[model samples]
Target: MTDTYADLLACEDLLLFASAAISSTGQREFHSGAAEQRLSLEFLHEYVHGTHPDLYALALALHVNDHNAAAIVHRLLSNPRTGASAGERARENALIRRRLAEMPPQRVYRLFARLARERVNNRRTRATMRAWIAARPNLDLDAVKYRPGLRAAARHARVALPEEVGVFLFSPPGERRRHRYGSPLLRAHGRAHYSASDLYDLPYTVAEGFAARHRVPRGVFLEGVRERATRAERLRLAGTARRHGVGAGPDPAAAPLLRLCVYVLSLPTAERRDRRAELEGALAASALRAAGPAAGTWPRTAAVLDDSYSSIGSPVRRHHPLAAALACHHLIRALAPDSTSHWVSGHTDPLTVRPAGPTHLAERILDALDTGPARVVVVSDGHDSTPPLLADTLTLWRRYVDPDRATAMVHLNPVFDADGLGMRPLSPAVPTIGLRDPRTLPSLVELARFGEGRLGLSDLREHLRATADAYLEAP
Candidate 1:
């Protein structure tokens, strides 16, 4: 990781700047590897106004003594993603015109942003997040609620209400996943498939999606849902069933409750954080009535890909000898274009895996629902081909839940310490709880009954104190 001063100066400055620009704005780069290989295409003179001001400064500091500018540029150019945008290219041309004037290249606002992100990484934000993920398996979606709630999920009107209402089930790895929403809403409306692809990719990170309630069901999606007679039918019926409202169905207490299962799957660490923020922002807006914090009780949400860590790319995981066909199917789909990605020029299509769609994500949600008997509502970004798979997964898991009561909600939530301060799941095979009714976020936290410790990220400071004490005892 050591570099000579002259080594840094000679690298391609334009390419470096472009990489930094993209990083600052948080945009995905469609064109990769073009900058590193193609150097001679833009036959411009060596410009001191290098692409990255910080990189230039570092190089300057290193090679300033040697006065060896060319050598430094050569080293920096070795790292890629340095192409300049049209405007930057024009600015470069102008700077070259006055090469004799030799003004230090002006700093772009973009560079500052990239540098800030760099500083944060250096400070260990990533390390903290990783530790959080690996700390422990905190919930089992199966045992979240008891029976009597399974018949009418996401509804409380049934007179035979269970002591604890089941909202959703969480299914982890190595288990059959299903969902009530498994059936494709699109199929009843038009000619859409009933099931979607499974989660083939392993270690897929998931989270409750961000977007305030009411504000959620985005305009684009709402329009689509409105077109669906079943969705409209359900909404209209729910309205009539409201307590004060007429024809609000049979329940006078069932508020205007619409449970949306929002799941952000396999997003990069940074994007995951961003999505969480978005969800928090939307929830905090109070645009929609809030529910309890749904402790780790999300519907069956697990990603099952062939175990191929240390692979070159996500696609390469398929090149192995011990992989399942369906696993490959799911992996390829996850590796393929995101729901909204556009094709590149002259590139018809990758002919690779296609998306499983919203139905698939929802099916997983529904499958998780079986782990317990509860009324649940699932919401997601609704992209990808998730809708179809959802319909099928539910019944499949139902059969698996219990052959006798085969369709009954399965006990997925294997709560290890139901009465402990920090309860976590212990089902090695599968354990996780689905999230239903997001307004229940507040209830998710089970504070220490004796007030010893709290359960959640916000309790990190307390965790740190305990860790520090343990370290002292060990020493």
Candidate 2:
């Protein structure tokens, strides 16, 4: 393949002077002293021979006979940009004046023409380079070579990368990428080839550059490919694919899944308008909070995956999704502590809900009541009262869900108050639906435990309320 650009480090730079000198007729005058003086052909030859400006001038100076002239030309050309220091330049000019006074003009012209040819070579190289630029294709995956493997696949793939790249692992079926990491087996014995189409992938292209910079040979650990990939770069690279169906749109919302004990509670009064307003309001505030100068924050959206937050946290910084997720998580935890570990993982983003501590209690309650969504009977201390709004949330869910498929998911905190009062709600008539005084919640749990068959909704609610009342009225 033809080289597309002439490395300025190597050639076209010299052509600038050659073109100028070939067209000029000397005895050109230059200022060697404070005043201008006519330069002898030989003197001029030493000053202009091989380098850009000098080469052209030397061509005009009849510099062919001067072998040493190239050396002087280099000396002046290589010196600092401000031009040579006064003392060194002055002495050099004196020596050139002596030689110019001795050489014939015809001999000078002959030497000048020869050196001009050297300058022609510079132009020729550039012309060739321009042609290459006009001909070569854009860099693509065909450029990279990977090892062969049966199950090579991109795992930590980034959608929009500033550069195209694909990271894959070679392993047996069902073995996660972690097992196949960039170990020597995958690097050597495994087989996977970098297809030209992979150049369209953002992460893969980035990895190529990273590999080149760090001197990492191909087929290395797939981790390095997407490790430092940023969200901005991913967004930019993916934009093209999105427009052309290259990749799916990223989920900017997958962030709220991080907090532990996260509970989403829609107020009992939540209507379509109210729910819309609440969600939108949360998003709006999230936007402004992230608009500040120091806004990057990624939370563990997945309950068990908080530590893995860094994997996507660094990239999420550019888009501010991390902050938004944190905002949602912060608000939701005040609602539901039972279903916190569950989250929705999607193509656009992953959602994390926190896991509450009393999973064991919740499990025991579920095992006992498999018939329907068990009614939740929370018995917690006054200090840990379940919010009134959250209490109604379970009732609201039961309205739409099948009892057999639903889970009451109770959080029973059986503890006495400072005044030695029970924590269960004393009456359903009390507008505030907080946990019954913690001491009284036990009677309700006990009633459910003694149930003959699956507790019907009305009966279960009645018994649970009576137990709360009895616990409260008891001395």
RMSD of each: 30.8, 36.0
Q: Kindly provide the TM-score of model 2 when superposed on the true structure, using C-alpha atoms.
A: 0.17
In candidate 1, position 151 carries an lDDT of 23
TM-score of each: 0.16, 0.17
What are the per-residue Cα lDDT tens digits for candidate 2 across 5-82? Answer: 332221222221221122112221111111111123223333334333312322212222233333333333233223
Winner by lDDT: 2
lDDT of 1 by residue, 1-475 (tens): 2334333332323222221221111111111133321232122212433334323323221112111222233223222225546654333322222221221211111221232334433212222223322231321211121111222211211222222222222223122123332223211211111211111110111100111212333332223333222332434444322323433222212222211111112223354455565533332232133322332333322222111121111231211111111122222223221211111111222222222211233334444343443322222211224324544454454356543532212111111111221112211111122122223222211111111111232242233334323423432
lDDT of predicted model 1: 0.25
lDDT of 2: 0.29
Error of 2 at 419 (Å): 38
Candidate 1 vs. true structure, TM-score: 0.16
